[model samples]
Target: MQAGNLVLLLVALGAVFYFFGWRRSYAVSAPLGGVRHLHSLPGYYASLAAVWCVLPALALLGLWLIIDDAVIRTNLMASLPSSIQPANEVDYNLLLNQIRNVAGGALNPAFVPAEVVAAAEQLVAMQARNQQMMSIAFVSIAVLGGVWGWSRVQPRLRARQQVESVMKWMLMGSATVAILTTLGIVLSVLFESIRFFQKVSPVEFLFGLQWSPQIALRADQVGATGAFGAVPLFAGTLLISFIAMCVAVPVGLMSAIYLAEYAHRNVRAWAKPILEILAGVPTVVYGFFAALTVAPAIRGFGESMGLTVASESALAAGLVMGIMIIPFISSLADDVITAVPRAMRDGSLALGATQSETIKRVVIPAALPGIMGGILLAVSRAIGETMIVVMAAGLAANLTANPLEAVTTITVQIVTLLVGDQEFDSAKTLAAFALGLMLFIVTLGLNVIALKIVKKYREQYE
Candidate 1:
């Protein structure tokens, strides 16, 4: 059986074990007159049995999957002639890929050396044998665990405590995995960024004001020089984000206020969903909209007003991006505004304040922290948008503050740098990691500032 099928079978066996454990609990309790005489409920006994039946088997299955490929590769290399043995990691990877392709029938064996053909056959046979052994071991362990758990089910058994302990450990493992994954990402990006800085001076990359990354990594291949300066990218990112915030904050916050405090329940129900649906629209669709419709309209409008707007301008991208992030602010703000105590609204009204005044003074102040968090999220979303910016705000790395001009952001440059086949060790490619690190730093600063604002406002409300 396949590993996935084996997992399904194991789950079915665990369910069967749970039923037996549950029935045994009731049988033991019936002799004592009722379940009240038992240390734990029948359901707890069932859960404990299920956990024992599945957990050990699942653990073994996961371990088997992790090591099986390495074992296969080791045996394959050992069986090969010394002449066929790979001398380095790169050679080994290339040779293994050829073998895999042949084994998978993507490549014909006749095209490769006889040794490769033999290795491909060996690879297939080993995989089949491994799956056979894995399935048998997985099933036997599951059955043994189920029988053991069932045999241990007694009226005095601390099933609830055992099950809860297992659950707590599982939750802790999940949290640890999350923390480690985040740490790994940051370290990887940081290390690569450091490598990039070693190749290019930090001062030139950070402060110099031109943005051309077309220079070849090798001097032999069209290498005049690439400008490593990121000032323009940073300026463009901030300019677009600022414009987006100007559009989103007022519109999203006011709509949130109206929905929470003034709109009829039926109006709110439909309006909120409609607004959220707008948010759920695919970003690629937004990109196309901006490219074809919004950008042209903005340019035309600017020209009509005796302004020289680029066909693909920052204003178009920012405006479309603002519309895209509206639900981020509106939904969160509406929820927080609605969460304010009803008595606060009533007291303000009793003091003869208008409904608008009550909402502004009472509800909004109370919800300021959450509103700030939502705006921060929207700002992040706007800054991170690559498609809309690429499609509308053309990738001209121009360092102008005017919304009428074309500009590009760090994300667009990162995507461009990493898109095609390029030398991984090249400064041009590594520049992506450096830009990513800078973007991360800017986002971290935004979070710190938002948190301080939230903390200050939260104190008054709490």
Candidate 2:
């Protein structure tokens, strides 16, 4: 039978078994003065008894069904004939795939061997019979266990409390999975970065001013050098991130203010989602628009104003990244602003302050922590951004403050390091991990500070 049908059958059998068990228990517990003298309400008592046995037994059966295929496949692999054994790991896996497909009646004509075909047919027949018998046994056990448990239930049983305890443990298990997943990712990144640091000195990687990653391909090659300096890339990253923050913070904050305080209800409803549409645009699309459209425009504008600008400039990339981040800042700012108590706004308005004045002097200061938190998050995004800088900013590592000049960022360098085929142990590849570690540290530091500030603000408000 199909899996769904099997499940339904199990459930139907469980319900029938529960009802019969309830009746048997009730008959046994009936007092001398007929059914009127029974200890509790009949249906509640019945359901309580039924739940103790039916749910647990059925759950176990379902778990078995889910794992049965893996168990059977493992056993079948061990039982395969010595003559048909695979020559290597790859061939073994291929044999297993063929066996599975043939047993499932999904084999193609290309690679069918006569002995393998016979073996598959035999295995399928055996597995089908085995599964059918297992299902029947499971249903029987569920029904019998339900009856047995119901017969044991008494008026003093604390069934509700027992069920609640089980549910609580289930929730804890779910929470543990989520927490473990986050910890696993952090540990993986940390370990790889540690491996990278073993090969290169931390001081040299972090403080050295030049960043040339090309290294010798062979032991005999001469005049090949690899510099692990990270300062220029980080400087470029900071410069671009600062420019992005400059563009995003003011625009996002003002847009948030207008939407939250000043705009008409209809206008706010329509305009907020429209502005947020920018966030949904894919990063790759933004990259090309930065490279093909915005970079040229910036260069042209600079030339028209009697200034020299690089064709691929940091200003263009930062501008586009800032536009990309505006929704992140504005959406978060809007939430925090709206969360500020209406009574505060009313109090400021009652004291003869204009709406703009109240927003600037009172509301904004009250919400400053949250706004700063949003800006920090946007900064982290800017630092981590790769595609826009790769496409628009030139790869030259120049340590300069001028936005008009082309520069490379840590993310751009990381992308270049691992883009095509290369040895994983090489300095070029290891440099990516070092850069990633630094990027993680910087973003983590910002987040910690932001969270602390936000916490303090919340405590004060409360």
Candidate 3:
């Protein structure tokens, strides 16, 4: 049976065993004092039985799914002739894909080697055997576990304690998995960045102004000694982000204040969702809007005013990106503002303070931490945005503070560097990891600053 079907069967079997446990608990209670004398409620006993019936079988099913492909591939590869065996991991994967396609009838057997066809047949047989064994073991364990739980279901059984303990362990396991995944990603990026730093001096990469990363094919080619200076990229990123924040912060925050404090309930209900609809629009759509519509408008306006504006300028991208991320700030701000205690507002009013005064003095200060959090999230969203920047801001690593100039960000450069079949051995490819590490550092610094601000304001307000 398939894993999905087996899971469904186990769930149904657990339900049945739950009823058995509940009924048995009542029967045992009836002889004593009709459930009043029982150690725990009937529901707890029912849950215990369900846990026993499902958990062990589900564990086996999960284990089987994890290792089933490996076991089948091992058996099939063992049967292949030594002469035709894959020499490396990449070759093994390619051969396995070929065999899988042929076995699934996506490829014709007449077009391939006889050995591969034979291996495909063996693959099919092994999978069928594995499935059969999995189904049997899954069902048997569920049945035996249910029986064990039912026999153990006496008035003295601490079913509630056991169930709660299992739940606690499950939560801990989930938290551990999250922590490990984050650690693994950080280690992977850090190791690759170390490799990149070995190729280029960290001082040159950090302090040099030029940002050309195109690795040359010939020794005599132009820019053969590619400049990996990240200063230009950093300047462009900050310039664009600053422009975006200027547009987003006041507008989004004011709108949020209006919606949360002053707007009628009906007006807020419709307006907030319509405003947040911007967030739901895909980044590619925002990119297209920035490229075709906003960039041209900005360039035309600049020319009319005798200003030098690139066809794709930071101003255009930043404006559209600001519009894109407005919902992030607005939504979170509204939520936090609304969360301020109503009594505080009432108290302020009773003290003769106007609603605006109360908001400026009491509400905003109290909600400063959450407001800062929202702004930080919006800043991260703006910094990480690649599509809008790529579309509207032409990929020029110009170290300029002027928003009218075309410029590129670290994310855009990273995408450009790692777009195709890249040789990881090259400094060009490893530069993406270095850029990623820098981005991580910047984001962490932002979080630290925001946390300190939050802590200071939070203490003062509290």
* Ranked candidates, highest TM-score first: 1, 3, 2
On residues 1-462, what C-alpha lDDT tens digit does candidate 1 reach at each position? 888899889979999999999998998899999899999999999888888899999999999999999999988878988888999999999999999999999999999999999999999999999999999999999999998898888999999999999999999999999999989999999999999999999999999999787876477776457888899999999999999999899999999999998899999989999999988899989999999999999989889999999999999999999888889999999999999889999999999999989987888999999999999988888888899999999999999999999999999999999998988788899999999999988788889989999999999788
lDDT of 2 by residue, 1-462 (tens): 655776687667667656765685467556544434545545555665566556666676678778887887777777778788889999888988897788777986357886677668767876887678777776666666676667665655554465467668879989999999978877776777777778778898889898888888775766266788889998899989988888999999999999999899999989999999999999989999999999999999999999999999999999999999999999999989988898998999999999889998878888988898998899899999989898898798998899999999988898898898978777778788778878888989999999998889878766
Q: lDDT ranking from best to worst?
A: 3, 1, 2
Please identify model 2 stretches exceeding 4 Å from their true place. 1-77, 83-164, 222-225, 394-397, 420-423
Q: Give the local distance difference test score of model 3.
A: 0.93
Q: List all candidate RMSDs to the true structure.
A: 1.7, 5.6, 2.2
Best by TM-score: 1
Q: Is candidate 2 or candidate 3 better by lDDT?
A: 3
Report the lDDT tens digits of candidate 3 across residue range 199-280: 9999989999999888899999998979999999999999899889999999999999999999999999999999999999
Count backbone overlaps in model 2.
0
Lowest lDDT 10-residue stretch of candidate 2: 32-41
lDDT of each: 0.92, 0.82, 0.93
